[model samples]
Target: MVALAKEKQKELVEAEKYVSEVYEAIKERNPHEVEFIQAVKEIFDSLVPVLAKHPKYIEHNILERIVDPERFISFRVSWVDDQGKVQVNRGYRVQFNSAIGPYKGGLRFHPSVTPSIIKFLGFEQIFKNSLTGQSIGGAKGGSDFDPKGKSDGEIMRFSQSFMAELGKYIGPDVDVPAGDIGVGAREIGYMFGQYKKMKGAYEAGVLTGKGVSFGGSLARTEATGYGLVYFVDEMLKHKGLSFKDQTVVVSGSGNVSIYAIEKAHELGATVVACSDSNGYIYDKEGIDLDTVKRLKEENSLRISEYVEEHPHAEYKEGCSEIWSIPCDIALPCATQNEIGEPSAKLLVANGVKAVGEGANMPSTLEAIDTFLENDVLFGPAKAANAGGVAVSSFEMAQNSSRVSWTFEEVDAKLKETMASIFTNSIKEAEEHGVPGNLVIGANIAGFKKVADAMIDQGVI
Candidate 1:
């Protein structure tokens, strides 16, 4: 069996040679492009069976069309600082795939923003959005201007300048970018305000993750985190267990982790740890969500601050070690590759039964393998963290209909969508003779949808 699996892997690699060539060409243009190439290649390699199953996809050269972005926009954003100094930054919007519908994703704002990262994210978004059963396509855009420690005026100016150029490419029926990472409600508001100013119209659907009064969905802030929990709940149900008495350890004290902890606690789970970039706080007795929220949301303090308020809690200087602590379930919501092989081994050894990703690609490939080998109920990011984009699609629907869905209505829809995604992923994995390998299942399931669309569209 091992030999046959190795042979199949080799065949898959060989079949992807042409797609690899395109990625190599991009890499030659810029060495930094390798990251994006590797990310896309991983998905492509797992999808070889789909190509074999549907010869029409190969006949139509769908791989080429899938990798190539439908549209790309680049522009310079010049904003003035409080000192009247003009700061110029480069911005990009990659509308990766829209065979399903208009491009949809998030706008990230950080110094780490680059074409490679955006492309990788956009590629992942394609699968993530598809799993939601929504009609939206995949796209991602952002600027390399970091908002951290920046004055309000500077952020406003940067956002306005960024939107002045971005507004030309985005619309209610075209590309829609929501908040991601550094981009949040404040940045969305600033960009939306500028977009409205330039277009001379109020287009609320132009961007998602908006403030509640500005047509944002009620659970938008909590969607990704809550969705992570929802996916885990379904996974546990298969094992005849639930979050009712489980203990969860989540990394990252940001939006996703905060809300995930909240939802886990609300569902009768004890959340023992939450981390930030610097470090994590562990309270075996269970974390104080209110205190954590105040420190993060109001004071904007590091997660270590929770230790001062809670005498029983301990703070660590490193975020990666959060997985070392024992828990019934683990959710890595910090950043890509934050959880690796060592972490995965630790969690499994500690008897962790499930892991639901709340961040995009948070687990390394080795980590994913470790989980699968241990028979851990794993939720791949594409299906697990899709709640954010799923709700964004709901917001788009409300905008098009000139109506707003009640909080209850939207939340119900999100729950149903997440449950369906898990069911589909499981069915696909089982059909492929890898019933527990959700990584491959998610890629194959998502690729089949887009591949079929490409064939139907006549090789566009």
Candidate 2:
């Protein structure tokens, strides 16, 4: 026992030094790119022991090359609003890696979109896609175009103009883009229409997240949320517990959160709260999914409107306060860095049994560290929230074969994929002598697969 402990300590020391060196170089090269730097640091910090085992990675400078994007495209997107005024937005697509396959990720259209943010998301996508063990690479694209308060015609025009430029770089088997924060069915429809117009071909595989009327997959809408619940179920089941009669608090009212609540209810768990950027809605009787869907999807109103229908429900002003509600499980389905040290401590104190991220990098480093130290069953975003992309791969396959799978078939596949991912992550963690460390386990497992592929491909 003493020798094993001493050897583990030495491994950690060597790992830390290697990680610090790589992190310093990344920080120096990418000045003022805080989000990108943070992301690179987090993954690098987790990869020390993995790197030490693979000397060829160091010889080829794979760490540095992987940190840099293979190709980044930036262009001007100009469209006319309903009032006949010309508006311009900056667009970007960062093809992070293509070793495993073509570029595959989502296109997010939010006001916060920037090069640093896109690069950070793209970098994370590389591992997220790799964890699925599918033939897909990592890429992310979007524009700083907020769709809120825009008329339907205005949005369609903006999407068309954006795709007019984006279509040139993307194709069915080259790079396929899906939807994220602000890019949903409506946006995808417009973009697909524009792509077809430009290419003069029906390339349904060029995009995911399409509505069911076209070549879209049936379970695409519910995949991410359902998959998250499925992953959490696997984790709890490992410890001989289930979501039966337990309370759950899920952040965000978007598609991921709503369907997660739906799946939780289907699995016999009572969901108590969900939130938006403005505030959160809490109903100890459990939130009504119909009302949430109506307010957010139908009316496009804030979550505060949910209180009007359910008078007993409370509407809080701050979105982060939702973490204060005691629950058996907490799922951050919202944006990046939503949970920091304070929220992590609060959730731990409130007895959150597990945390599964539905959104990318929803928890800060401090929060993740705290969860690890406290022995909380924390699921990293790369492994936990990969269901959406996994299903997207299914969609691509369906389109390629000119077939549409039934909803049951797709849902079953998604559940199996999520379970496989959870099992693999645990297997990797245990083998690396860091049982229960999903973050490290996911990083190492995904990195090794990509690294070996990159090496075999001869350092392109």
Candidate 3:
């Protein structure tokens, strides 16, 4: 018994040592990429148990290969603004991994688009795509082009110019880019038109978020939000609870949050609050999804406008205060690191029961630890927000087959995909002897698939 105990201790020590060495190497290489380092650290920390179980991953140097992107493309984007002045911006694409399938991800156009943020998103995409059980690898591209307050012509020009350079590196089979942040249906339409014009062929499969009139899937717009609720509903169901009669808070009035609010309402939950970059709106009578859509989508107004239409609702000036609105569930659909440790503790204090991340890495590592320590039913972004990409893959199939499905058909597929992801996450967690811990379960489940594919492909 003494000898066995010593052997187990030695194995654990070796695992911890391997994780620390690789983490330090990653930080040394990416000194200024704080978000990338955080993401890599989170995944690596979760994989220590997996490393002890499967030493072959270390033998094959998978950690080193996976952390390093296959190609990092950065370029200058110059376009003429409405004033005839030349506006310059930087664009980037990080094709992180392709062992599973073609490079697939979204192109974000927020001012926050840095190489660090893009790399962090791309790195997380690897596992997120893997969890979908679809034939799509991980990649992310974008520019620091803020579209707010920009005219239609200006956005069109910028999207076209951005794609003129980005188009060189992407295709249906090479890499497919979709909408994110400031990039949406209108922006995607402009970019797709440019790609079509440049190639002189209608390659509808090259982009995922094109207008439904072209080749976009029916439920693609609602996939991530609806998928988030679906996955969380499963978590709640596991605890013998449901979204029925639950009060919820969703941050962000964008596509993801809007649809998440819609779905939560459908599931008999009242979503009392949603936010924008400027501030958040709390409507105790439940957020009017149509009013939010009209304000954000059609009129392009701030979330504060919701109160003008509904006098009873209150608008808070800060975005982070949205977390302070007590509720049964909290969904952060806005951006990365939006929820810090303090906000997480506040949610816990308010008797928050669940947290489903609707955005990529929305919660910090410390915040996640707080939720876990408090026994909150936490749904990580990769597994919960994968509905969008899953539907994107479905759109790819439709484009290839030259047929489109009804909204019901696509939505059914998305719900099933979310349920499957939840099941796989828990099953993998239990198998790894960490039952009910979806974070470690999801990381391991997604990592194993990519790592095995890399091993079979023989060290590219």
Candidate 4:
């Protein structure tokens, strides 16, 4: 195992050397983007065979340019609260690539927002978008503002102020941003309204995840969650198992967790646990979707509220303990690094057959190593969470055509895309003699398409 890891590390180093010239050229401009650069390098290293097979990409220096964004926009968002206090936050928009089409990605608003996080997300978006076989390029933007306890009015003012500066660089053709993390339908509405008011015209395509009354597609809210289940279903089918009768635990009480729970229940799985940052609630009986949704969306209450309402449920104080519960399937729908090596060991010891990431990089490097070493079926974040961006790309298509797709139509498309992504990743991994290494498969498959496009376009 140590020898195998060394081999993988060596391959990664070689891949970095292959793109070192491009990395050095952009290093100055992209200072503090080491995480983003590291992820790109790791994926690029795994694609050495693909690059060798497709020499045209090398002939055109696609590897060099694809690692760098086409444009990066930074601006300040200042807003006045209802208390008459002025607040300031930093905002970012990283337009990673536009070789396939206009930039398309989500805007993540959270207290943790930083250029490095946005760049990592945008970098991942490049491959996730490509895996869908769509024409959308990759971009991501957001602010450092936290909307947790903020009043609707306060959030509205902040979103408007943020858009006032962001409007200058984004458009349907140039770039498009949607909702992510702290940015939801409400935030999107505020930003969209501000963009229209500033431009003196209405362009629904400018932002996605909008309300249906505006331009949002049906199933957009549930796309990420449903797509997650669909991908897991495919993975299970490959192993001759299914979601039926499986006890599942999911983290996060937001959109992803809510719908993930709903779909898991629908698929005949008992979702035993779900959580939020403040704590987690577990019930022997499956969690009720309607009750969980109301507590989270309507009351803005924590998971503890659910425990209060359901006497049978138990609420744990810390968020990390959610992984300690025994389950057949575990979905990490929360933030990055929420699941570490110890938590991974607990899941493996308790008989977790598969672990799918519903959030971006929810597992740490050690956790991933533990899962891989245990031969646990693991779905990496890039492939698992690609559902959200895939639907956003679909929304972009609907907006471009000036038409909205029915929920059934959009949902069918999303399922098909997720299945295709799973198949492609598995196929690529098998080709590289790493049959279940979806992390490598996802990186290679996603990188090949974008790299080819970059090569075809030539030298930025």
How do the predictions measure up, each by TM-score? 0.94, 0.97, 0.98, 0.92
Candidate 2 runs further than 4 Å off: 1-15
Candidate 1 lDDT, 1-460, residue by residue in tens: 9998887777556556655665566567557675577677668767666655555666777776788788878889998999999889999999999888899999989888889888889989898888899888999989899888899899999999999889889898888999998899999999999999998999988999998888888889888988888988988997798999898999998889998999899899999999888989999999999998999888888888888888789999988889999999999998888888998999999999999999988888888889988889999899999988999889888887878888889889999999999888888878766776778788888888877887778755
How many residue pairs clash in each candidate at the backbone level?
0, 0, 0, 0
lDDT of 3 at 441: 89
Clash pairs for candidate 3 = none
**Model 4 misplacement above 4 A:** 1-34, 52-61
Instruction: Compare candidates 2 and 3 on lDDT and give the better one.
Output: 3
Evaluated with TM-score, which candidate comes out highest? 3
Candidate 3 local lDDT, 338-358, one digit each (tens) = 999999999999999999999
* Global lDDT of each candidate: 0.86, 0.92, 0.94, 0.86
Model 1 misses residue 398 by how many Å?
Answer: 1.0
lDDT of 1 at 358: 92
TM-score of 1: 0.94
